[model samples]
Target: MRVVLDAMGGDNAPQVPVRGAVQAAKELGVEVILTGKRELIEDELSKYSYSGNLIKVVDAPESISMDEQPSKALKKKNSSVHVGMSLIKNKEADAFVSAGNTGAVMAISVFSLGRLKGVERPAISTVLPNLKGHTFLLDVGANVDCKPHHLLQFAVMGEAYAKYVLGDENPRIGLLNIGEEETKGNELTKEAYKLLKKASEKGLNFVGNAEGRDIYSGDFDVIVCDGFVGNVALKLSESLAKILAKILKEEIENHFISRLGAITLKPAIKSFKKRIDYAEWGGAPLLGVKAPVIISHGSSNAKAIKNAIKVACQFAESNLNSYIEKNIEKYG
Candidate 1:
């Protein structure tokens, strides 16, 4: 499969992304097209050892920075992120991967690739690691304000990801709300609950409302919420994990006995970090788009970038767009 990557997207820019492209090409056995300032990307790439032909570089002179306005930056046709996305629209690449500005990525993707037929809005579905396995949360930061039907569509898309990508045969769908009752949440969620119930008739495994505490408990495989709530939940979960790790280390250092205990539990701690680390999942997919697009964290490292490409390859291979389009029509 051919994957196009924005070599200038992440915090470390060409360095990390270049290494990732090489890794994906060498280890994943896939063709990688890196779009960015050609000189810079090549300079970073020269430091790595890989097959000369597996990776290709496309020159995109401009780059959109994090602080720039997403809508405005998208106007730069030569920007690396925009160019990377365009590669998919032109059918030159199977998927696009970026660790750039989230807003710009979303905006450029919609403008370039458009939404899947019958999909009103494209939602960002993030894979959150949980005890049983993992949970797929949608609209993480895409549409802050949403209508009732939008949530229903998000549920449908989330369910598809859970089943196809996560390997769940029948994924349970839940609405993120304050209470588990059907009568809970604002007007939007309340109405969405009714729509989801209707969808269950068409084969959706619609579960009841999922409280915030249920997020990591793995009680539900897919959780639907507006971008505002989902973004807050995602950020809070990420911060809490970091803080908890720091607290654990501090507690261990406070006592010699605790330090000795930590040494015995070091293996467990590493496993725990791997479970919650965003790098492990690579990046989140922007569902409901015309083409497969993977968006990684802005602070992604080489491993994260490489894994994001792997995810892009998986997405392209799944033919997820065809299934999503059919599912939307089934319920539309």
Candidate 2:
């Protein structure tokens, strides 16, 4: 499988992404096409001794900045983000991974790759590591404003993703709301709940409403919400994890005895850190699209990029698009 990487997309840029591509190429045994300035990619590659020539560089002079509007940036034919998406559109690459501007990635993908047969709006599905496994949260920031139908579609697409990625036969899905009762929430949530309930009769594993507090409890495998709420919840959860980690580290270093204890508990702490790191999953998959596209964090590092490629590869191999299309009626 050929996985395309946007070399100049993230904060670390060519170095981290290039290193990741090389590592993925060697370990995952997948061909990686790095899209960026050819000279920079080669320079980075020369710094490390790699096993195979599975990692190739594609020259792309232009790049889309985080602040650039998606529509305006897509006009730049030579932009790295555009070039990378084009690879998927042209069938030259199985999937596209980028840590660049989220808007640019989404805009270019929707324009070039197009949406699935019955998808009204393509949503970004984020995987949150939980005790049971990972919870798939949809509309994580793709569309700020959404209709009830849009949310219902997100639920359907999210369910497909959870089943394929999380390996759940019938993943339990929840609608994010203020209260768990079907009668609670605004008009949108109320309508969405009803739609989901109707859908559950057919095939969807819809479990009533899921409040914000219950998200991290691993109560459900997938949580569906509008972009407005999903984005806020995602950011808050990420921030909370970071703050808690920092507090724990500071407390551990407060005393010499604690420091010694920290050393003894280092392995366990590291494991906990890995579990809470959002980067471990690499990036969020932009579902409901015709092809696989991953939007990585702007601050992603080498390991994150590598994992993002794995995510793309897995999605492509799972034939999720066909699954979503086949089950579109259940969601509609």
Candidate 3:
């Protein structure tokens, strides 16, 4: 499979992304096209030894900064974000991967690749550690404001990802709300609840509302919410993980007995950390787009970038967009 990487997208830029491309080409056995300043890309690439054809570089003179406005950043046609996304639109690449500005990535993807047939808005689906392996959450930061039907669309797309990519034969879908009761939540959830119920008749494994505590409980395979709520939940979960780790470290160092105990439990601690690490999952997929588009964190390292490429390859191989289109038509 051919995957395009935005060489200048992350905080580490060409350095980290270039190293990642080389690793992916060598280890994953996939063709990687790196888009960015050709000179810098080659300079970093030269530091690594790999097969010539497996890794290629495309010159994209401009780059969108992490803080740049999405709409304004798109004007730079030569930017890495635009160039990488264009490669997908042109079918030169099977998927596009970027660690750049999230907004710019979403905007450029929609403008270049367009939406999948019957898709009203594209949602960002993030994979998080859950009790039963992992769960998918949608609209993580794509559309801050959404109507009732939009939530229904998110549920459909989320279900597609769970079934196709995650290999779930029947993924449980839940509306993220304050309570499990059907009567709970605002007008959006109330109305969305009815819509999801109707969709369940069409074969969706629609579960009732999922409360905040249910997120990591693994009771639901996929949770649907507006971008505003999803984003807040995502960030809060991240912060909670970090703070908990920090508190553990401080306590471990506070007493000699605790430090000794930590040493004995080192392996378990390491395993726990790996479960929460974002790099393990690589990145979030922007669902509802014409082709696979994986968006990684701006602070992604080489491992994260390489894994993101793997995810892009998986997405491309899954033919997920086609399934999403069919599901939308089936449930709409």
Per-model RMSD to reference: 1.1, 1.5, 1.0
How close to the true structure is residue 130 of candidate 1, measured as C-alpha lDDT?
Answer: 91
Best by lDDT: 3
lDDT for each candidate structure: 0.89, 0.88, 0.91
The Cα error of candidate 3 at residue 206, in Å, is 0.4
Deviation (Å) of 230 in candidate 3: 0.4
Give per-residue CA lDDT, model 3, range 210-272, as digits (tens). Answer: 999988998999999999999999999999989998998998899899888887898998998
Candidate 3 regions off by >4 Å? none
Model 1: per-residue Cα lDDT over 1-332, one tens digit each: 99999988978898889989988888898899999999998888888777569899999999899778987987999999788877887889999999988889889999989999999999997999999999999989999999988998998888888777778889988899889888988999999989988988988789889999988989999999999999999999989988988997898899999887877897997887787888989998999988889999999988999999998888888967888888888876
- lDDT (tens digit, per residue) of candidate 2 on 30-114: 8999998899888989998895879888899987888899888889889887788788888899999999999888989898888
Backbone clashes, each candidate: 0, 0, 0
Point out the higher-scoring one by TM-score: 2 or 3. 3
